[model samples]
Every structure is written in C-alpha cells, then in structure tokens.
Target: MYTISDYLLDLLNYLNVKDVLGVPGDYNLSFLDHITRRSDMKWRGNMNELNAAYMADGYARQNGMAVLVTTFGVGELSAVNGLSGSQAEKVPVLEIVGTPTLAAQYDQKLIHHSLGDGNFEHFQNVHKELGFKVEAITKDDAISEINQVVKYVYENKQPGYLALPVDLTEMPVNPIFKQLIPSLFRNKNEPHDHLQNIEAISNQLKNSHHPILIIGEDVQRFHLQDVVRNFIINNDIPFADMIESKGIIDETLPQFIGTYNGSLSKDLTNQLINKSDLILLLGAILTDANTGGFTQSFNSQNTIDINAKRINFYSKIINYNEQNGFVNLIKIISQTSLSQSFPKGPHDSINNKLPVPSDKPITQDFYTSAMSNFIQSDDTVIAEQGTSLFALEQIKFPANVKFICQPLWSSIGFSFPATLGSQLANPKRRNVLSIGEGSLLMTIQEMGFAVKYDLKPIIFVIDNHGYSVERVIHGMHEPYNDVPALNYSLIPEAFGAKKNQYNYFDVRTEKELLMAMKSIENNSSQLSIVRVSMAASDAPEDLKEFGKIIAKQNKG
Candidate 1:
C-alpha cells in the first residue's frame, strides 16, 4: 500500500532532512499528511512561502540541505525571494512544489497568483532562470524524477526542484520504483596527492616576509576548517574573514584578526594586506561588499587566490595559476617549510579591535558584542540585510556555531522565517534572529510558525523605520524613506503567541537594554523581541560616504 508520498518521505529521510519549512495547502496536503504520519521528517509550519524558503535556507546553511515545500501559484511565488537568494549564494536546497493535478494545471479559469493565460510552466521557468534545476512532475515520472532531483541539488551545492503532481499522490506504487536510485557525479575540483601549482604556492609562502590569509563561506561549504586552521597555525599566517565566514579558526589564536567584511583593511589592515609580498586566499570570493567594491586603495600587487577550483600566485593580479583543487593546494601549503614569522599590523600595539559594546545606543560593534555574549556557545544566529550585517561582522563565534543570512540576494524578510528552520534542524540549539523592522514586516506572518512549534528565539528587531540601508546609500532624506511602523511589542500577540510564553522588550536607552538582556539569562528559551531604536543621524561612517558617491553620480 506504499505510495509516492511514502517514497518522497524516504527520499527526504535519506538526505537527513528531519525538518521542512513550508506551508501546506490542498495541492500539498498529501505530502503534509506524509510528514505528519511519518516518523522520520518533521515539519515547521509557516504562514507564507517566502518565510518558508528563507527558513529552509537558514537551516540548510547550518545543518545541511533544507527541504522547502509549498503549493502551486501563490505559494510558489511567495518563496521567490529566499529561493532565488539560495541560488545566488550557492546554497544546496531541496525545494518541493505541489502542483495541481495533471489535468487542472492549464485551466483557463482565473486562479490566485497563477499565470492564467495557460502558461502553467511559469514556476519551472522561474526556477530555471534563477539557476535551479527544475523538474515538472507527472504521475509516470514521479519516482524517477524525485530521486534524480534530490541527488542533483544535494551534490551540486545549488538550488533544485520537485514539482509534484497531486494525482501521483494516490497512484499505486510500482515494484519497479525501488530501482530509482540517486545518480552520483564526481567534481572536477577533486584533489590529488601532489600538484605543481601547489608546489609553487608552497615556495612563495616559504619565501614571503609577511603572508596573510583571507577566507569566506566557501571554506565552510567545502568543509575545510581543519585544513584552513592547520595551514594558518603551521605557517603563522594572520587570517581574517568576510563576516559570515568568521570563527573558521580558533579565535584565541594570536594571528587571528577581526572581521574584514566591510572594514576592507582600510586604515591599517588594507595597508597590511596590500603591502604584503605574498597573500594566500583560501576559499574567498572577494565580493564587493567584503572588499568595499574592490576599492582597497587600488592596489596593483597580485594576490595569490587559492580557492577550491584553482591556485595562483602573482606579482599583480591573477598571474601563474592552476584551476584544480584548493584542498590539494592547502595540503601542499601545510607541508611546506614556510616561515613562521609573519609581520603584524602596524597598529598591533593599539586597542583597536572589533567594537565592544558601550553604555550607549545600539551600534553594530556594540550590538554584536552584546549578542555574542547573550547567545550560548552553540546558539544559531539568523541575520537579515542592513546594519545587522555590520553587527554580524563584528561578533566572533565558535567553530561549530553558524550564522545564516541571504547575502547573495541580500533580501529582507529572511531572518524572521529562517529562525523556523534553525529551530527545526536542532531543537536543542538556541536560535536568535537579527532583522530590521522593515525586513520583519515583509514576512511577519511567519512569526506564527514560531509559536506553533514553540521554537523560541530572542528576535532582535532593529527598528530604524523604513529601508535604513537603502536610505544610507541613496541619501534620499524624504518622507518616502520612512516606514509605517506599529508597536513592535504587539507583534507576538498578533502572531498568536500566548501571553505566558511570549516576551517583549523595548530598548530605547542603554540602561533598559542592559536590563532586558540580563533578563534573557533567566528565561530558559523564549521568543523575545527586543526593539532597538535609532536616530536619523546615526549611520555607518563609510555609509555616509557611499551616499555622497551616489549623489555625485546622480548629479546633473
């Protein structure tokens, strides 16, 4: 009596996907039933699809591939922001779409959020355009397609698809279905025992007067923490990260520098890295946000880029290179007889480090420091776009802890829903959310999902009115820049949270915030929202300059 729904559960279980973030509807009810009836997979309900997708992304970033399930039309459209972001950031995601039965899909009748002109292929089209491998399911193809879709997305580190046909839910299982196994493919970047480019890199590291290493999420994606740390410690190379990639090394290491996410080594760090004769980059993408649009004083000296694909050392820009496995290069670098005496920052004697909190209004450095102390060693941090990004850049976490954000897309509304995934993935791990007020309102309904699961997190709502980041960039000081905000504390009530279980803290003054934060230590685990207030005058110092540049570029 086993059906496609049962096989689907088995597929999810095989991927170790115990949690799914999504909304259930008529089209997807059979799948939902399977989730409810089965013991292997657990469901974290969401009020909308966007939140579901984001939660899935957050969970995937931490635990593994996240399962995001949704119904057709409105449900599919609702999740576009998060799914597209996962695609942009190279997160492996398993997105399951529940389509109308094979017959009603192209009906000319007006349906909500559907491309009613009979283009039922819109969902698949959107997925393809966004770089996700899509599969439109028919009753006949259900077994084979589901198996293949899961395998491709799992191994490729990309978003993938499964468009389910409702009719397949009730179809009788065939004995031949057991033969549908996942297809395996090997990566071109696989490592070997020895490599020439790696040997050259080893030589460079050995000869260099000062060499620093930069890494990003790619290290985590490739699971090279041990290799990265060993290389750094063995070579005595100073290292820094691009916000989300912090904590790859033991922060206690003397050579471990603070974040370079937006700071861009500007005053001291820029000079240190740029002035270096040799720089080894391990799994860093060097995006505009991390390098401040690559305007690190316009250095002409070549940087050695050692990513998963290639290894290259250069006098200026990319020079001698090999497009092979960085793992092998790292191994070669680790064994090399490199000098251990690397130069330190000129300001190493100074107290200038990542911003520690003060008894003042919220600043990125201060906020992150406080948050770092607030969360336990294993707590998960789910971040959204804007000033929160700056805060995440400042706090250092343990190697096992994770910070999830939709950086590639940098979309709002992710932090709120992503918490659902984090909670579902590891029930014991504390989940904390960092999001701006504008971002929270985008998918505020997802808060109900939190209450439903009783998944508690201290959600810090950075309440600075509307679109703070955009305002900082554009300098559009008009009424349009402000958002219509409600009482931030009332959100929990509106989201169906019970009074006894919900906690609200409005932090306007420093003293109040300190008190609220202290109270958090006593609450075992509660979904508390601490609203942080900011003045219009407050912004990142570099952000003001960015706004001026935008104004100058627009000048007539």
Candidate 2:
C-alpha cells in the first residue's frame, strides 16, 4: 500500500524535515492529501505560495534543511521570489512542484497551469537562472533523482527544484536512507594537501605582532562555532563580523569587537580593523551591504580570506579541489600560535544597556537600546532589511542567539513569514521579529498561519507611516515612499487570534514602549505584537550614510 508520496515523505523525514510549508493547489491536491494524511510529515498551509517559500527558507536556516511544496506553473512562479532569496542567502530548501501527469506531457496537452504552447519544460528552464538545481522527475528515476537533489541541497547549502508529475505519486518506490552529502564538493571528505600553504599561513600568524580575525556567515552555515570560538579564545585574537554574519560568533565574548560595515562602522571599529597587520577573514560574504556599499578598506596583502571552497591569501587564489577545504584550513589556523597580543575592545563595557523610560517620543536610538534588554538569551532575532537592521547593529546580543536577515537580497517583507518558519524550526526557543510597517504590509497574511498553529513569536512593527528606508535613500517627501497608516496592534485580531492568545500594544512614547516591554515579559507564554510610532523623517545615522552612498552610486 506504500506509495512514492510516502517514500518522498520518508526521505524528507530522514533529512529532519518534520513539517512542510506550502499552499494547496488543485494540480497538487493528490500529493497534498498524502502529506496532510501522513503522520511523519505535518502540512502547514500558507496563505500564499510566496509566504510559504519564505517560511520554508526561515525553517531551512534554523533547521539546516527545509521543504516547500507547490502546484506547477502559477504556484511555482509565485514561490520563486522566496526561493531566490534563499538561494542568495545560501540556505538549503527543497522546492517540490507537483506538475501535470507524464501522459499529459507526452501527449503535449495544454494544462491549466501551462502556457498553452505545449511546452512543459519552460518553467524548469526559468528556474535554472535562479541558481536552483532543477529536475523534472519521472517514475523510473524518481528515487535516485530525489536523493541526488537532496544531497546537492544539503552539501552545497543551496536550493533545489523538482517538478514532480501527478501520475507518479502512487508509484511504489524504495526510500533511500543514504545521507545527502554535497556531490559537487569533491574536497569535502578529502585530506589536506599543500602542507606548505598551511605552513605559510601558520608562520604568518605566528610572526605577526597583531593578527586579528574576521568571522562571517559561512561559520554558521558550516556549524563551526566551537572551532571559531576556540580559535579566538585560545589564541587571544580579536574578531569582528560583517553585518550579514552579525551573530556568527559569541558577541558576549570579551575579544568580540563590534560588527564592521565599511565606513558605516563606528570610528573606533573602523580604526582597529583598518590598522590590523594580519587579517584572517573567515567565511565572509563580501556583498555591497556587508561592505557598507563597498567602502570597507583592508590591505589585500595583509588579508587571508578563507571560504568553504577556496582560499585567498594575499594576491594568490588557491581553489579547493580534491584536497583542501575549510575543514583542513580551520585546523591549520586553530593550531597556529600568535607571537604578540592585540588590544581588545573593553570587556567590562556595559554601554549597550537599555535606557530608562521617559515621556519623550520613542526615537530609533532609544528603541535600539531598550530592545537590547528585552531580548533574552537563546532568542532568535529576525530583522527586516531596512531601519530595523540598521538600528540593531548598535546592540550586542547575548549568547546562544541567532540574527536572521536578507541584507544582500534586500527583501522588504521577508521577516514576517520568516518568523513562522524560524519558530517552527525551533519551537522551544523564543522567536522575535523586528520589521517596519511598509515591509509588514507585504506578508502580513502569514500571521493567520501563526494563530492557527498556536505559534508564539514576539513581533515589533515600527510605524513610521511609510517606507522609511526608501525615504532616506531618496524621495523623502514623495508619495511613492509613503505607505498607508496601519494599526499594527489589530493585525493579530484580524488574523483570527483567540482571546488572550496574543498580547497587543500600541506605543508612541518611550514610557509607553517601556510599559509594553514589561507586559511582553510577563506574557511570555502568549504571542505579543508591539507597534511603536516614530517620526517619519527620522532614521538611524548609519542608514542615512548608506542612503547617501547608494544614491550617489546610482547617479554615477
């Protein structure tokens, strides 16, 4: 009685996917029934395919892997935006599109979701451009194709798309229990080669008087926290992160310097980073956002940048083949001893403490500091790509926490849907989302899914009456940058929240915000949403600088 659908669910379960995020479509109804009825996989229906894809992305980031199922054509196209964000962020999400039957395809019949031109492979070809390993699955190679796709996703930390035909759902297939290792990473399991390169790096660190390290997002992707922590603590090297990799290292550590966003960093941070003798840049994603619009300055000759697949030491580029990767490189770097010590940032500095509440309106400065205290250890903080992210850069997170954002992709409404995925991935942890009103307007429907599932995530909606980020970048007084005023506190109720299930607050002043924070603390078991109103003209200093830089670049 076992079917291919059952086998597919089993494989997903093997990959530690307990729930699937997607919307049900008629084309995929048969497979949806199998998922909804199955005990191994729980189906969480989203309001739309885009939100489903974003939720799956958030889940993948937290759980290491995730799945998104959608109907072919329209559903698949709608979910592509989310999948593209995941692909850009290097998250592993398996995208399954339940397509028309093989018979329909063979006969070149026009389907409801098709283009009517009798071309079945057009969508798959379109997906190929988005960095997805796309495959149109058939009965004969279904199991093998699934296995291969899953492995590619896990090993490469990228999205994979599979167009699953409806007719193959009932076909019996053996569930492969093989691990999904990266097929393209030939050097993943290989031993270290070029001991000379290791020697050169070790000697460089040992001889340097002030060798500093820079941590980045790949450390979290590769799960190298312990190795990174030990390397920093054992060698007494000061470390800083690019904005995208904010919480990759233990921020509470004494040796942890603040994040560097090129010229956007504070004066002290910029000085220290630029003055480094030997800079060991590990797992960095050097995007314009991460580099503060390409303003970050480092001596190329003094920098040794090591990523998952390659090493850039000085002017030389050594690619990882069947010999070396981060595994071997990290080992060599960890064992090396520095000859001299570098001055670390103040260890006893409690500069980021929350401010005492007053009757004044809640400014971005005050809100950032207050939130530092509101956030607890082990909480996952998700910020939208604008003012929320820029303000949070000033706060120092506690231990065992996560910070999720799409700085490079710059998606506006990603945080709200991502919160659902993050909470589902780590149900026990407290999940908090910080997003502006404009961004929230895009994916607010996903809140209904949260209420239906009884999931709790503290959400902060910064109400500035419009697109605050856009206004700063350009068109400060323009109508296009202004969003309709929303009563954000009513969102949960509108989304069908039960009585006392969620605590809602609307705070315009510092005193009100402080009271709201206390209320949220007391109602930890319930979902909470706080709406804080700020001046439409106000923005973080760093954001203003970024806007100017971006505006200037656009003009040139």
Candidate 3:
C-alpha cells in the first residue's frame, strides 16, 4: 500500500533515476516529504526552478533519465525553459509539478500563482510544446498516468510533464501498480524495421564509393555511443560529429576526424564531408548554429539520415518500425562488404600547433591552447553559451571527455547549474565548466548548491567585462552591451565556502594563467575558480563569423 508519490519514486527507480532535482514550495512540500521517506531516492534542492530543470537535464544526460519536481504556475513556468531545451536536445526528463489540491482546482479557486482568471489548464497547454506526452494526474488514474508518461519518455527520448495535485501526493494506490509498472517495462514502442532497414543501408553502402558517418546529439541521448563506436571501428569508416555531439566518439581514434560544422569547419573537414559520395548521418540534427547558419552544402539526395524512428534517403521518408533500432542496423552493417578504407579525415594534417604565448595579455587563441592542454581524460566539460561555447570548440578533447553545451538553444546560465547535476550524476569524474561573466551572473546562486553538496567542479570565468558575443553581433561599442566588472574570485566566500574548501585565482597574463593551473593541480580537493580576463571586443574566430551571419540574417 504505497502512496502515489512513493509509487512514482519507485517508477523513477526502475528508470535509473537516483536523485530528484527541484526547489521546494508550499504546494510541493507534501511531495517533498515523500521524497525524503524514499530510501533509494535523494532530493537535491536547488535555489531556483530553472536551475533545478538544468540540473535534471544534466543528470538525465548522464544517468539515462531524471525527474524534476516543482510547484504549480510560477514554479512550473520557470522550469519550462529548461524542459524545452531538453526536448530540443532529445533528452529524457520527467517534470513533475505539484499543484493545488483537487478540491481547489475543482472549485476554480484563485491561487497565488495563477493569473486570477481561475484557469489552471494554460500551463498544461504550454508544456505540450515541449514533448508529445503530458498527463495531469488525478486520484483515479495516478498510477496509470505516471507509468504511461515515464514509459513514453524512455521510449521517445524526450521530456514528459506530469502535474500531481497536493491531495494525491501521499494517497495510497492500488497494490497492482507495483506489478503493473514492472510488467510494462518490456512494452516499449520500438522501431520494427530492423532487418529490412539494415539490408537496405548495407546495399546502399556497397554501391557508394566514398561514404562517411556523421553522428549527432541523438547518439548520446539514446545511449547508443558504444554500439555506434563499434560500428565505426569495425567498418573502418571515417566519422565526425556535429558541434553539440562533442566527445561522443573518442577524438584520439585514428578514424575519428574533426567536427563538421558546414562552412565553419576546417577546410579539410569541409572538403572531406562535402565531396563525399554518400553520407550516413546518425541522429544528426542540422540546426542553424551547428551548421554555420544554414551554410552546409550537402546534397540531401546523397544523404541517408537515420533518426530514432524514421530514415530519410534523399527526399523519401521511410518510417521503419525496428525493435532493436539503430543497434541492430549497425550490427548488420558491420559484417557487410563495404570498403574498409577512405581518405584520411581532417584530424591528420591539421596544424593545431600553438604559437608562442603572447606577453601582452590573455587572448582567446591562448586560452584555447591552455584549455586543450589542461583538460584530461574522464573530464566532463560544461560550456556556457556565447563566447565560451564557440571558443572551446577549437580545443582537442582527450578520450572519455564529455563536452556539454546548449549550442542550439543558446541558453545562458545553463552550464553553471548543470555542473551541479553532472557532478552528482558522475561523482568520480572531474567536471570542468567554462562560462563567461555575463552568463555566470544569471545563475550564480547555484554556486551555493555546489558548495552545499561538496561538488568540486573546476570553473573558468572568462571576464570580458560584458557580453562579448553580443558586441560581435550588433553593438560592438554600444553601452547597452557593456556590463560592470565585478571581482569573481571572491564569490566562493560569499557562497559560504570554508577556508580550505575552495581556491580562487584572477589571471590577466599567460604567466598568471599557467600558475593558476599549477595551483589547481596541487590543490585538487578544493573547488577552484580561475578568472581569465580578456578584451571586451575580442571573440573566438568561429563566434565572430557566426555573429556576422546572425547579424545579416536579422537584417534580412
């Protein structure tokens, strides 16, 4: 005789959710108590609802799935942005919002968070834009609704929304639910055209002369990295990933080449991908930001784009119902007689050689080189939007390193709180965050959450004095783009960091930056912060080109 909340927690446990990220509110306090009672699940409280959603996203990206709890109206609305981003990225997250009691909603009572019109269904419609599955749980259908939404999230790799009334939080549910949820585990809606699709793809590859594999965010979101890696290595195929899929494959692998970002890619990368006779795009999303503002020149007729449930060959759309999905397709293709060799990708013959350290001050070029050498294997890189996102793209990541950034959504303040969630998800791996001062200020309160949880992610704050990316876009010297310079090194103390618990460094020169890196190496336990100061107008080379494209697009 478990309560609905307990049943929900158990369902989440079956989905591998070890922790729930959320902020507390009066409506959700009852549900929070149940979260406290569950021995297998822990509640990670955040300072705000948006941060909670980002934390849940990071957790889901690492742990397969994540649940986030928030209150009705205000709380749920604040979390909508994060949930939408997860949907755009095709990550699986369950957003559970605690609402007023059933009676209050029935009577249409005016609530504190409502718009005074007594309409409670507005937010429900709003969240529908995020994913296909959404359920407003009731006393009668609590178990079934929770089960359905969770199953849909797992099957589809998209976020799900559930609004639980306060009255139903601890209400006991049917004992049959325990057995039902476990039984439904085997009932996922898998693709059903595995054999035929694999044969088709194999035949196509056999006919092609130059074939290349392009991976994207879907591979990571669907947890097919190992299978995809095996396929690439066994087939001896040259492969590349989109900007958002950094580190999906080990960059150190011989067949693994540089990232392909349409025109923004290196000359060699563009030449290899653009001139190829056949392109097998696996779960790749060709967004404007990742494709250099729609400058990609690949012919759709020659591309075989494979998504979760559908395959696109040229202009034809084939919906394949495959039970094993891309895994089986890859397995069959591995044994096929496709050519095992192709022209070397751009990774070789590319000069990533760093120039001599400039004596003047820290620049984006030097920073990228410093970071390339500083990052090690098993490190998760959390990159904030704007300059931090585009700048870090040039760095060479070590094996097993993950690069997390919101390039498509371009949401600021995401990486700051995301560090908290990713660290908690993978506690053994070191988390390194690169964020600008403007972006950091948006969710700086989450720094306290990191301190409270004893998370030691190395944070790099690029102190450019303002929104450098914005300046590049339109207002180069406009005062509207400028922001005040605040001392970032002292923020740890303000966030309640104990004496030995944290270390801070402010660097304006290459010498100072290297010294800070050495100090961080020596003091590994402390949460270290290294502030890199740079010119206000300067930005990464790719970022500069992107801004120009965006500015032109806006004008048109």
lDDT of 3 by residue, 320-391 (tens): 554556555554565675564677654732225655665669988788878877788999998988888887
- Against the unseen true structure, what C-alpha lDDT does each candidate score? 0.70, 0.84, 0.83
Q: Give the lDDT of residue 41 in candidate 1.
A: 73
Question: What TM-score does candidate 2 get on C-alpha atoms?
Answer: 0.95
Which wins on TM-score, candidate 1 or candidate 2?
Answer: 2
Q: Which pairs of residues collide in candidate 3?
A: 191-321, 191-322, 191-323, 192-321, 192-322, 193-321, 193-322
Q: Which ten residues in a row have the lowest lDDT in candidate 3?
A: 346-355
What is the lDDT for 353 in model 1?
A: 42
**Looking at model 3, how many pairs of residues clash?**
7
Q: Please identify model 3 stretches exceeding 4 Å from their true place.
A: 187-191, 321-337, 346-358
Which of 2 and 3 is ahead in lDDT? 2
Error of 3 at 324 (Å): 6.0
lDDT of 3 at 354: 52
Q: Sort every candidate by lDDT, greatest first.
A: 2, 3, 1
The candidate scoring highest on lDDT is 2
